[model samples]
Target: MTDYGHDLLFGTFTTPSAQGAQHVLDLAVTADRAGLDLVTFQDHPYQPAFLDTWTLLAYVAARTERIRVSGNVLSLPLRPPAVLARAAASLDVLSGGRFELGLGAGAFWDGVAAMGGRRLTPGQGVEALREAITIIRDVWDTEAVGGVRQDGRYYQVVGARRGPRPAHDIDIWVGSYRPRMLALTGAMADGWLPTIEYLPRGVASLPGLNARIDEAAEAAGRSPRDVRRLMNFMNVSFSPDDDGLLAGPPARWVEQLADLALTHGVTAFFIGGDDAGAIERYAAEVAPAVREIVSRERGHYGSMP
Candidate 1:
C-alpha cells in the first residue's frame, strides 16, 4: 500500500460546451450544493463549440459558493504564463481562495497553430511547460524583491511586475501522463491530474507511471508524497450490477476508491459527467464512504505494532 497521507477530495468534471452553458453552470452549482470539494471544466480553446474555460471558470466561481473550480487542464500553449498567473490570482481572490489550477502542456498542434499558438514537438512542449511553470510561479511570488525575470527557450519575461497575490496558496495541478511530463510534474508541480481512461493499460498503468513520478521526485531531492495523485474518471456509471472500474453501484465505487487511496496513493477523485444525480450520489454517498474507509484503514495501519 502507498498511502500519501493526504485528505481525500471528491469533485466533478463537467464539459464546457457553449450549447450547454447554463447546464454546465447548473452542474457546478449542483456539485457545490451537494458538498463536493471541487468542480472542473474541460479546456479546449480551439473547440468552437466550447466556452472559453477561463471565462466560464470566473462565471462558475461567482455562481457557486464553496466548491473549488478549475480547468480539467488549461491548455498552456494558448495561455501566456504571466497573464495566466495574474488571471488565476485574480480569480482565486474573487473566489475567496476557492480556486485551483489544473494545467496541461498543449495538445492538438494543428489546432494550436491555427489559433496562432506556436507548434511545439512533444519534448519542446514539456520544456515549454516547465518554463511556463517557472514564469507563473515567479509572477505569483509577490514577496520576491524584484520583478520576475526569466530568459527561457519557450518564454521570455524581463522584469515583469508581480502583484495581486492569490488569497490562498493555489495548488498547481498538472495534467500529465508521459515520462517527461510526469517527471516535470514530480519535480515542480503540486499535483498530478491524469484521466484514467487515457492510460495506455488502464489502472494497471498507474504503478509504473507513478513510479516514474516517484523516482523523479526522489532524484529532484523532493519526497514523492510532495506530488498528490489525482485521477479523473470519465467513464463512470451508477448501474445495478458490476460493469467495470467505476461503472458499478455506489458501494462498489466507495470500495474501489478506498482501495485506490490505500494502495495507489490517489488522494483526489474527479468524476467526469454532466449527470446531476451522479454528482449528488457521489457527494452524498460514495465520497463520505470512501473517506471513512480510507480513514479507518489508515488508522488501523498506524496502530500496528
Candidate 2:
C-alpha cells in the first residue's frame, strides 16, 4: 500500500496581487468560510506586482476565523531564519496556531541579488536551507532557555535568544525539486512540498523521488513517515474528455487525488488557481470525495492480513 498514514489536507494557492490585494484577501476569507484547510499565497518579494506575502498572511489570519495561512514557499534568501522564526511564532500565536511555514531556498537569483541578498549556486542553496531549518527549529524551542547557536558555511546563529513558541507545532514544508534538497527535506523538514510543474517526469517519477527521501530519512534515524508528502497541481479542468492531469470534473479530481494518496503516499494537496469558483468546487466536492476514497482504501489496507 502506498498510504503513509498521514491525515488528508486540502488547500488553495492564491496569488498576492498588489493591484488586487482585496480580491485576493477576499478569496482567502472565502476559502476559510468554505471549510478549506489552508490558504497559501506565493512570495515574490522583488516582484513589484505582488503584495508582501507575510503582511498579507497576517491580515488574512485576522480576517478569517479558521484556515491556515502561509507563503506557498517563502523566499529564505530574503527572509533571515533568525527574525523569521520570531515572526512565524508570533503569527502562530496571534492566529491561534493556524499557520504553517513553507520555504524555498531561493528563486530568481538575479532578483534576489538585486534585493541585496546573496546569490547562491544550487549546492550552496541546499546547504543554506539545511542550516536555516536547524536554526528555525531551535529558535522555536521555548522549553530551552538558552540562546540559539549554530555555525555553518551558509547560515549561522550565535547566542540568539529563543522563545515565543508557536501555539502549535508548525510544520516546515520545503518546496524542493533537486536531489540534495529532497535529502535535506527528508532529514530535517516536517513535509516535502513540490509542484507537478517542476516534476518533469510527472507522477511516474514519484516513486523514485520518494525512495530518495525515505533513504535520507532512514539515514537520519527518523521514520520515513515523519515527513509528509505535499504536492500542488497548477490547474484542473472539468473536461471529461481530457486525459490530462487533474483534468475533468469533480469526479475526475477525486480519482486523481485519491490515486496520489493511495499510490504515491501524498497526503496534502494544494490546488493552484485564484478563481473563487474553482476553490469552492474543490472544497465543496472534490475534497470530500477524495477523503472518502482514501478512507475506504485505508480501511481495506488495514484489514489485510
> Candidate 1 at 148: error in angstroms?
0.4
How high is each candidate's TM-score?
0.98, 0.97
lDDT of 2 by residue, 1-305 (tens): 46678989999888799999889988998899899999988898999999999999999999999899888899999999999999999999999999999999999999999999999999999999989988999999978867899998978898999968999999999999889999998999899999887897989889989989988998999988888999888776666575778788778788889999989999999877788888888889899999999999888775112
What candidate 2 gets wrong by more than 4 Å, as runs, is 303-305
Compute the lDDT of residue 10 as modeled in candidate 2: 94
Q: List, in order, the clash count of every candidate structure.
A: 0, 0
Give me the candidate number with maximum TM-score.
Answer: 1
Would you list the clashing residue pairs of candidate 2? Answer: none
Find the candidate with the highest lDDT and give its number. 1
**All models, RMSD in angstroms:** 1.5, 1.6
TM-score of 1: 0.98
